[model samples]
Target chain A: MIEFKNVTKTFGKTTALDHICLSIPKGKIIGILGPNGSGKSTLLKMVVGLNKANSGSLSIDGKNPSQETRNSISYLPEIDYLYSWMTIQQAADFVKSFYRDWDEAKYKELLSFLELKPSMVIKKISKGMRAKAKLLLSFSRNADLILLDEPLSGIDILTRDRIIETIIKDYRAGDQTILITTHEIREIEGILDEVFFIRNGKVALNGDVETLREEHGASLIEIMKEVYSNENSQW
Target chain B: MKIANGSMLSTLYKKDIMSMKLENIIMLVGILLGHLYFAYKASTGWHPGTIPFTSSTIFSIVLFVILLGTFSSIRREWNNNTIYLIMSLPVGGKTIFLSKLLTILTQLVVFGGLSVLLGILSSLHFLGSDLLVEGLGFISKYQLIQELLKFVTLLFIGVIQIIFVAFFSSIVGSLFKRFSGFITFAIFVISNVIIGRIYTEMLKLFMHLHIESTRQSISSEFFLAQVGLMLVISIIFFFLTSAVYDKKVEL
Candidate 1:
């Protein structure tokens, strides 16, 4: 449901995405795997219309990303984006007012599943809980596309497992498309239908996990090491 | 299940206002204490002249708060990374801009209205109603109402113009990755200068065209025409700034 044609984004002298082109199909769980500064987050941000591509075109579902497209794209950025003064419930209500796809039942279910109290203030909550809160808000919406940028980064292993479980439990295969970016491959490798290994703002390798394993005769993590080692570029 | 556009706008307006609740309360308390202290002083046989001076100072403080709030409201989003949430919303840039503008205008009206009322009441209490009425006796009540309306219109237009300038400068500043604060301050100063010059020229043009030989001072028609000109400029800036915000500003 997302297409990037020769998209290149540069911040000052450093290029974030370099003339990269890729197509992400609808209703599939896709993992965009890369190390830090590998343009994974940049690619996701471009899809969500937060970062504009400098040269090439990017579109979702045959339409350009804009305010209207944002309705269908639920994004969980790698930052604390919620207001500090708001409780999780207040933030949910504020977000719910803007989206028609908001599922109250799903929200409450995720709240309990995530072990997040509705009355917990965002500022007072721990980082892992805040990440869970962000995930809750995102998953609450029945958006056609969900972009999770570094959701597992800096999160504890337990919280990360819970987050991964949250994704797997609520995710409806063939109904919602999820594009997640992270270097933490082993944890998410099992859930991903397809994986794209990005390096230095370019796609180094991508394919279906099963097909890739069959062809390479190795696990995704071993394959990741092979890919990075074969490339001369510094990580 | 989606809300209509009007409701969305109202929801955004409410959120903006809610965000400022703490600042509003602090301002309210400050104004209240100022009034009470002055009231206490007035009752203790203090000089009458200090009442008007102190009341005007309070009004100035309110104006200062409005101007500062106009800039900080937008900055707060960036400081807290909440702009990510705001930009991700389904609403366009115009809605975001207008909601903020509406919130500031609402505060201006509410706080400004209170200040004017209290100022007049305190003036009356200190100076007595007879003297105040005598001062106002020179003009008919209709003329007085007309003048009051004109003043309010001018004040509103002026404040709106400043808000647009501040918004434009802030947006322009965001275009750069470094030294954005200096850039924003510089743009603000330059924009105010250019706008102030244009405003002065426009006022002069209107006054010259509308002035009559029989008139000793500037006519009310000139003020109305100037207010109209300012309003049009503010609207143009509003649209331009909103367009930039929509297509250009990157989060």
Candidate 2:
């Protein structure tokens, strides 16, 4: 379980997260839905311990975000983070050295399923293939928590579908928690168990996907539109 | 299977070393070629002064490389966006820091030793075997060996001190969100100034204590004391740098 109590993060004069309080239960797929600059990435970065909170506290599995918590969390940033000189196989081996929960068999399966050869250099691969490579490294770990930031961004439609499929295929239901932040909501709407709608660094709305759908009497796309429309009108 | 801590450190060392593979190769080839060119000149003309002058110039270039590399190593991670991967790793900051420091030390030993060897060979070629022996005729062989040992020890400490200061300054600079390069430069200059002041004080104290001793014994004692003090100071900088790296750096 991950808990945030009055957590606020700021960069210069811009507030990234505003006194936010939320608890993410274990073993669920949660979508942190927000447009660019709405603090979606900052929230994910906070959970992964990449960014620090200015106030309040954050805990992962009852422990504060630190080196110990990092062992249980696998994070895939929105940008390309892999070393360009490393091939897919070398990257995997490098990650495996630092993570005890790395699963070699799962890594191999994902490699073939994603159609990425181990010998393919990261620098030489296409952007779509690089996205798959990132997914391969993240899913290969049996981490308690997996955070994917903008996984679908810049990816081709076919590759995006494959990435979503790979997420579903590799996910261990009821044993792992996954948090994903992305703008391509329609493609991943079917897989999210819960969704948090953030606006201007605040949690505008959050609830179970099915419950939110029923209460709003519309699909997530419609709800998203209505929520943003209301904010725009108010402004 | 779980990787032991030793295995993890080894992996880190290998990765860091591999990052500098091209730089190391270039350094090696460049130094060798430079030595060969100088050796050829010495063979033709036999200028006694040229070998020492060239060797010192080579030393200056190597020192410049070390200084430049200390900053570039840290900056490259940010430029490539690989800091994200490195920062997310489960290892502690000290481990990350130790691997990089070990890589630089390895380079220093390998290239420094090679240059020293080549310099000695060139000296022999220019001075000839009998002249080299006669040049050291005043001192006993044991005393000459002792003096060489002292010089090497002092060189090692001095280089480590400089590297530590640069490393510490770079890590401190990384903690900021703006103008990190300027900040690092400022910190480097300020810290060196502070250390230089303290070293001067220590030097005065050593001179006062060894005033009654013979010049040879006094200098020997002073050199040993300087090495001991620098080692302690370097260790302090290591801890300070690693602490910042572990707790403060953000990507």
Candidate 3:
């Protein structure tokens, strides 16, 4: 489980996360729902150790995020972080060489399912293909926690479906934790078991999807619009 | 199944080299052609002085390549957004720092050695059968070999010292995502000036600190003190780099 106890992160004078307190349990897919600049990415990065909070504490599995923690966390950053010079094969081999939990057969299977060749150059690939490759690399690892930041921003609708399907196929049932951040609530609402609605760096609402849906009498998309569309949401 | 740090380093280094493989290939081909041309010229009685690449040119090229490699390797991560990928790995800041340093060091040693080989081959072409038999006073074969060894050693140290400077500068730049170019340049220039002066002043201080009597010559002590200062400073810069990476660098 990843726990954040009054965690606050800031850049210069701009606060990214303000006194965030959360507990993300293992073996569930949690969708972090927020509009742009709502601190979705910051929260995900903090858990993955990409960004650190200025105050308070964050712990993954009852320990602070460290280099060793990365062994069990497979992170897919929001931006395109793959080197342009590497082939699809080389990128896989490179990431595989770093993690002890990398599964080679799974990687090959994902590559085939994604319709990507090992020899395809990353720089020359289309945007959707790149997404597929990134997803494949992220999913190939047998990590306990998977943090995906904006996994479907630039991809087409077809690729989006493929990506979501691949995630469902790859994620271990009730044995792994996946934290995904995306503003596309409608596209992924069906799969998210839990949801976190962040407004002005605060977790305004967080609960199981069924509980939230039953309590609010609205879908995830309507809830996101209502929570974020408020001018007072910018706390 | 667990990839060790050694394997990770090698893979990273290989990735670095693979990115530069095309440029290295072009450079190697050009150098080979130049070597063959000079060899042919030497066979036809062309003098070494007339050749375009003297010892100085060869030395400059090796150093230039090292400088290019150092800057390019560090900046490429940011320019390509690969820093995210590199930092996300299940490795410590020290491992990343060491891999980058090792990549630059490997290029220096390998290319520096190649430059020496080319220099010798060119010299052999000009000297022919009389390559080792020359006994011309101070230019004797033994004297020449000693001087060459000393020169290579000094050059190696110089390269390493500058690498530490560049490595530390790069880490300092990594601390800021915006205006990092200006920051890196400012740090490099400012620190270079400050450190250069400090080294000179410290050498004199160390010299005076070690010598209490009039008979203890200053020349050898000065040389040793200078080398010692460079090494100590290099290590300090290396540690500073690792510290900044661990404690300060955001991503």
Candidate 4:
């Protein structure tokens, strides 16, 4: 489980993440939904030790996300972070050398699923293909926690569906936790067990998806639209 | 299967070397060939120079290649975001830094050794058929061996200094969000200028004091000892950089 306690992160004078306190348990798919500049990415980065909160503590399984904590967590940044000059095989080998739980067979299977040639340099691939390759590398690691920021932002509908299905099929349950941040909530609503709607720098709304739907007679997307629309109506 | 915890440093070092491309090898070879050609031309009367100067120039060229290659390796990794992957491993930042240092050191030694071997071959050719007799006449075999050892030691010291500068620059580059390369270069230049000024001032003071005996006492062994101390200081600075990197907030 990952917990953020009174976490407040600021950049210059603007607050990127307000005093946020939340506990995410193990074995669930959580979605972080927000529009641009909503601090969704900052929150995720904080959990992975990429960003330090200005005045609070974040812990993964009761431990701060130090180098030791990072060993158990796999993170996919929102950009193309792979080395451009490396062939897929070389990248895989490089990653495998560092990770103890690297599943070579699973990595190979993911490559075939994504239709990526092992010998091809990453810079030569299209954007969508590169995204798939990144996903393959992150997923093949048998980490206890996976944090993916904006995983489905640039892909088409068909490719997005494929990625979603791949995540669901390959994800190791009970022993692993997945936190994904994306704008496309409806596409992943079926797999998301919990949802957090962030506005400005705070959690505007958060609850179990099924419970919220049953109580409010509305889907997660409808609630988000209503809340955001009403907030914008005053302007 | 997992890589054993104890051997992780060696594993990472080996992988770093394997990741080098054919292009990098070709560039190293090109530099070596260029230096060798210059040495041959100077030694064979195509250019004018005393034997010691020619040898020293050849040695300096090799040293320059080693420094360039080491710095370029780190720069390539930084440009490609390979450092992110490297830093995310279970290994400590110190281990990763040390592995890279060792890798660069090994490459420098190998390249430097090859250049020395080429220099010896060229010298033999230039000295003609009485190669053994001429070498014996110039210096005793034991003294020649000692000089060769000193040369190797000096080359190693120079390589260590370059590594220190390169690693320091990389840390500076990674610290900021914008114009990192420019900022790192500026820091390097300013620091070097300050050090140079201090060194010059000390030399002037020594000359003014008429310390002839002090100047005469400085030998190759003394120089090597000073360089060894500098290498230790470099390692400490590298450790500080790694600590900051491990805790830095990446955007």
Candidate 5:
């Protein structure tokens, strides 16, 4: 489980996460649905301890994210993480060596399923291949919590379906809680047990997807659109 | 003492070495060639009296390599967005900073040793022709080693200072998301100029105050003091870098 208590992050003039608070539980696929600059990535980065909060506290399993927390959490940033000089194999091996829970068999399966060549350099890879590479890295580790920050961005529809399927397949294995952020909502809603709509550095809507759908009579995407449109000062 | 994960540090160190393999090779090879050329020229009567490249050549090359390595190791990570992967690793700021600092330091040692070795061989080459300290008595091996050691050790301290300066600049650049390249340039150039001026002025004041009775030279204690000053400043800058690194924004 993860908790953010009045966490705040700021840039020069803009507050990325302004006194925001969030609690994310385990063993479910949670979609942090928001448009760009909605503190989606900032929230995830805080959970990984990549970004320090300006004020307040953030902890997972009652402990702040640190070197030990890194062992339990896996992150996939939307940006290209593979070193430009590395071959796909080198990058995979480098990542795989760090985790004790790394499953080589699963990694091999994902490599084959993802259709990524070992000899391919990361900088030379296509956009879709790069996406798959990021996905492969994130899914290979049997971490307790996996944070995928817009893993579905900048991809074709088919690739998106493949990514969604890969995530769904991995989530079904259990004991793995994934928190992903994305603006593209229609594809991820069916898979999300819960959704957190963040806008202007605050959580606008936070609840179970099914209950919200039943109560509001609208899909997550529709609600997301509504959340952003009227999210002026409060959410 | 704060514990550091050794294996993770090695992984980070290895990645930097792999990324910097070509530059490392070039620098290593350059040292050999520079020494051989300097030695070969001095052996013959082609150059009348003065050695073409002395300590200044070594200093120039060493400083250039430090700058290039620092840029590739630190600034390149920020530019390439690989800092995310680096920062997210199961390690603390101390681990990241020390691993990188050690990697560059180790490279400096290797290259620094090569420079020293080359200087020694050039001395011997000149000695073989009886051109070294020509007007003075034959220079003993012990005296030669001491001289080279003094020069190299002083230069080593200088190289460390330059490395830390570039590192601090890289840390500053990471604070900004946009135009980080510009910030890095300004930090590296401007900070170096300001620090260099201050260092020279301080050194001049010290040398002026402590002039030996002969007026020919100051004591070895002066060089020791200078080395001590340089090291203290380098360590302070390193800690500053690590402190910023610990709470750095993942921009």
Candidate 6:
């Protein structure tokens, strides 16, 4: 479980997150929906301890997201994380040595499933392959929580479905929590149990995905469009 | 369960070595080849005079290798955004810093040991030649060993100094983010100029103070003491770098 208590993060004069409070429970797929600059990335970064909140506190499993907390969490940033010079096998070896809970069998299976060559340098891989590599690394970890920022962002529809299916298959029931952030609402709608819509640096709506869809009499995509339009109407 | 700190440290040290990509082996081979070439050249009438084949060359090569190894190790991690992965590990920042320092020291020691062995072999090869027999008689092996030991120690300290400077530059670059490359270049140029000017001024001051004494009056002990002081300063800088790196926010 993760909790953010009255968290506020500011960059110069602009506020990235403003006095937001949220509690995320375990064993659920949570989707963070927001437009560009809606502070989705900032919130996730704070939860992972990459970015410090200007004023409040964030805790994962009752401990602050320090190095110790990080051990229990896997994070996949939108940007490429694999080193340009490291081959896939070398990267795997390096990462495996660092984590005590590293599952070598799972890692090898994921590599094969992703069709990644062991000796291939990450820089030479296509973007889709790189994304798969990142996914493999994150999913292979026996972590209690996983934070994936825009995992489906530049992939084709079929690849996106494959990625989603991979994640669903690998999901460790009742032991792992996953928080995915993206603007592509429909792509992940069926997979997400809970949805949080962020607007103007605050959580505008947060609830069960099915409940919200039924209440609004629309799909997640239509609801998101309506929410963004409503927020912009005030501006 | 409480983890034994020693095992954790050893694990981190091993990881750091692997991350360095066998830099130590490459340096050892490079140093051996360089010294062997120089030794062969000196013995084959390439240079008629006695070659300055001292332990200092070995120490210099080891120091250079360590400097390059440490810089590339840390710099590559930062450039590749691997610092996030490293910092996010279960280890504390202090442990990470100590592991890096240990890795750098171990690399330098390995390279230094290899260079010494190669240097001795090269010296023996040179001494076997008839042309160098006459010159070799004048050099005292005991004195050479002592001087070499002192120079090796000094080189170790110098490598530490270079590591501190590189670490400082990395922290600065990380802070500046987008302009870090340009800032690091400018800092490199300016720092060299500043150091050169300071060295000249210090030499001038020392000369003025000892105007009455002859050059012969100044002993090797004086130079050794100066190097010792530099080693102490380098240690302080190393600690400073570790402190900054531990607390500084990653951009």
Q: Give all TM-scores, in the order shown.
A: 0.95, 0.94, 0.89, 0.84, 0.83, 0.77
Better of 4 and 5 by lDDT: 5
- Name the better of 2 and 5 by TM-score: 2
What is the DockQ score of candidate 3, to 2 decimals?
0.70
What tens-digit string does per-residue lDDT give for candidate 2 at B1-251? 34577777888888888877888888899889988888778778868668978976886687678678877777778889988998888877778777878888888888877887787777777767786677677456436667778777877887788788888888888878689899999999998899889889988886677644355543666777788888988888888888888777777
> Could you tell me the TM-score of chain A in candidate 3?
0.96
Candidate 4 clashes between residue pairs 3 or more apart in a chain or in different chains: none
Candidate 4 CAPRI-style tier: medium
Query: Which candidate would rank higher by DockQ, 1 or 4?
Result: 1
Please provide, for model 1 over A93-191, each residue's C-alpha lDDT reduced to its tens digit, 9 standing for 90 to 100.
989889999999999999999999999999999999999999999999898899999888789999999999999897878989999988888888989
lDDT of 1 by residue, B114-187 (tens): 88778888999888999777877855643566666777778778889989888888887888879887898899
- Give one digit per residue, the lDDT tens place, for model 3 in A113-198: 88999999999999899889888899988988899898998899999988989999977879999899988777788889998988
Please provide, for model 4 over A196-226, each residue's C-alpha lDDT reduced to its tens digit, 9 standing for 90 to 100: 8888788888989899899889888888887
Among incorrect, acceptable, medium and high, the docking class of model 6 is acceptable
Q: For each candidate, how many residue pairs have backbone atoms clashing (under 3 Å)? A: 0, 0, 0, 0, 0, 0
Where model 5 places Cα greater than 4 Å from the true spot, the runs are A172-174, A229-235, B1-4, B25-51, B54-59, B109-128, B132-138, B141-148, B177-229
Clashing pairs in 5: none
Docking class of 1: medium
At residue B212, give the lDDT of candidate 2: 43
- The 0-to-1 C-alpha lDDT of every candidate, in the order given, reads 0.87, 0.85, 0.80, 0.74, 0.80, 0.74
| Poorest stretch of ten by lDDT in candidate 3 chain B | B211-220
DockQ of all candidate complexes: 0.73, 0.69, 0.70, 0.49, 0.45, 0.33
lDDT of 6 by residue, A63-172 (tens): 87776677777888888866666778877766665566678888888878777788888889888888887888787778778899999989887778778987888788
Error of 2 at B220 (Å): 5.7
lDDT string for model 2 (A1-235, tens) is 8998999998889999999988898899999987788898999888877889999999988888888888888999999999988899988989999888999999988888999999999999999999999999999999989999999998899998899999899788899999999767889889999999888888888999999989988888788877787555221
The residue-level lDDT of candidate 1 at B114 comes to: 84
Order the candidates by TM-score, highest first.
1, 2, 3, 4, 5, 6
